[model samples]
Target: MGVIKKIFNKSRPSNEKDGIFFDEMKKLLGFKPIALSHYRRAFTHRSSNKTDAQGNPINYERLEFLGDAMLGSVIAAHLFTEAPTGDEGYLTKMRSKIVSREHLNELGRDLDLISWVESNVAPQHFGENIHGNLFEAFIGAIYLDRGFTYCEKFIHKKVIGPYVDIARLEGKVISYKSLLIEWCQKEKKKFHFEVYEDNGVEGQKYFGVRLKIDGNVIAKARATSKKKSEEKASQRAYFALQEKINIK
Candidate 1:
């Protein structure tokens, strides 16, 4: 109780603007915030370089880590009960797909979490990952401010109920490169990915990948990383051979 009171007292919004902000937050969260500091830290970017009274660096990164674990735990439990017939490998794959970076980024975008971020850096300069990181940090804040039950409820409402359709998830491919490779091997098709360093605009070094199937270039792509370039190339290849890929 003393700790909770201290947190509330330390950063209680001191203006009408803060009051209105809390009201909006209440509507979004479905509860009055007991520790507004947690949510504030959740939305704070590392660019702010904030520190607590104890001089410990405070940002959303740590909260994001905790939230990731919480999300995985809840999702794993759900999968375990929903698919009793699934073996260890199957369950693990499903969880990976559900908690994938792409999916989390989508969820964060859906929530418009970026608008709430407090940062010294320009919002436009931030990467696509900022959205997902904020969402995870928000979940961590919820867990700390409320409890595991509220955290689970939020996950169920936002993640499980709307997004996690078991049948649809089973067919979902989290990595296009892996899927493409699997298809190639299964079809006994000779495939190779030749990756080369290709520097681009602003002198930024990039990787160019050309995907060859049976000695023919199926797709070519470039990205900041070899793996990303390969994945991009695989995505194009998957679309080109969508009919043969046998995925709907």
Candidate 2:
């Protein structure tokens, strides 16, 4: 069944030159591919305004959903099989940490997924989530194009093997705010965040914050809301404490 799909894909014409996509795909995937359309759609950003005959948008979003599921399933299975002594809560948190958005964005950025996006929207304007979204979408494309076994192979090779560093990531905090709070609490320091209205960007309400620790203004940051602003402020504080923090 998969072989038949491959032949049909080979017969199809592409606006871009042949072998170029295939070769690039090989380098990116670390293996030569039998079909190219799946990758083309994988890389195609929603901004391109493309759709298929069934009126389904020919973007990576749907595939991203599928890939996200696949990733979660695979990661869960790995955790279950390997960590025999780990409890459910431990496994769940570990899985969440592994599949976190920040991690996914890092993977996508490292893979240079942005270069292949076919968006009408300027890549510069994209939000932080774009990288993670595209990464998931790319996974979806691989799953559909090659089926489950190959999808597992790709995820294991690209995601699990290369990126999932267990011990290092275990001590990592996905939220800078939590780390900052813990530091303040442990050091017995009086810390507070002051938020002020941005009064700019009519449609979006922005907030600015200053994180003061031990009567010392450690960082100032801004974001769409008070929470985001505080998180950003906390992140700044964490970076400022680069030399001090245990980072464990």
Candidate 3:
């Protein structure tokens, strides 16, 4: 209570905009922030060209790195406690599923974290990965302002409580491409993903991939990038050969 009051006092907004931000952050975090500056830094983009008094760049990249470490540590500890029977490999894989880029991006989108971004670049120009980046930077801000206890609490409330289902996660496939490759290796079958062609209009180019298995084309797919096209092709191939692959 005393600490909360002190933090609230220290973080009181001096202006209308600051007040709105403070309230919004309080709503998002479920607690008043000790230092609003950390979150401001979290939302700062490199394109904004922001710098601190000492001429150090001020952007969310460093906070994203810190938050990533914090997320891994907290999630790992939870997995360690919850899955005692899981080996190192199993634990690592499960953690990956929970903290997957897709999952983080979903979380960020749900929270509408991107709305707070301070960037010179237009929002339409930002890629899908920016959502996940903002989410990680937000976590980093929580860690900086409130410490590990608050960080753990926020993650638990927002992440673990809702999404960390062991049974569901165990069956979730993080990468169909990896799964297809592993199945092929296990069955002693040669598999390849080849970029067959580039498609789409100017400024929206797409790559076409052919997934070949044992000299025959298993599946083909097109996407904005080679990696995405290959993944899509692998996914199609996996479904085409689902019975034969029999991933378990």
lDDT of 1 by residue, 1-248 (tens): 98865665455366787777677677677666777778889999999989999999889999999999899999999999999999999999999999999989867865778888988999878898988898899999989988888889889977886567676577656777888888888888888999755666464456789999999999887666788778778877886786465644
Clashes of 2: 1
Q: Give the TM-score of candidate 3.
A: 0.66
RMSD of 2: 9.8
- Residues 135-167, candidate 3, lDDT per residue (tens digit)? 999999999898999999999888886557686
C-alpha local distance difference test of each model: 0.82, 0.77, 0.86
Instruction: Give the Å shift of residue 143 in candidate 2.
Output: 0.5
TM-score of each: 0.64, 0.64, 0.66
Best by TM-score: 3
Question: 1 or 3, which is superior by TM-score?
Answer: 3
Query: On a 0 to 1 TM-score scale, where does candidate 2 land against the true structure?
Result: 0.64
If both were scored by TM-score, which would come out higher, candidate 1 or candidate 2? 1
**Alpha-carbon RMSD of each model:** 11.0, 9.8, 11.0
- The alpha-carbon deviation from the true structure for residue 231 of candidate 1, after best TM-score superposition, in angstroms, is 23
* Candidate 2 structure quality by residue, lDDT tens digits, 1-248: 76776665564335467657776887777655666788898888778889899998888878889989988888888888877888999899989998899889867865769888888888778787888988898888877777777778888887776556454467655777887788778877788998755857666466789999887898887666789778767866776676576633
Question: What is the Å distance of residue 84 in model 2 from its true position?
Answer: 1.3
**Runs with alpha carbons beyond 4 Å of true place in candidate 3:** 1-11, 172-248
**lDDT comparing candidate 3 with the true structure:** 0.86
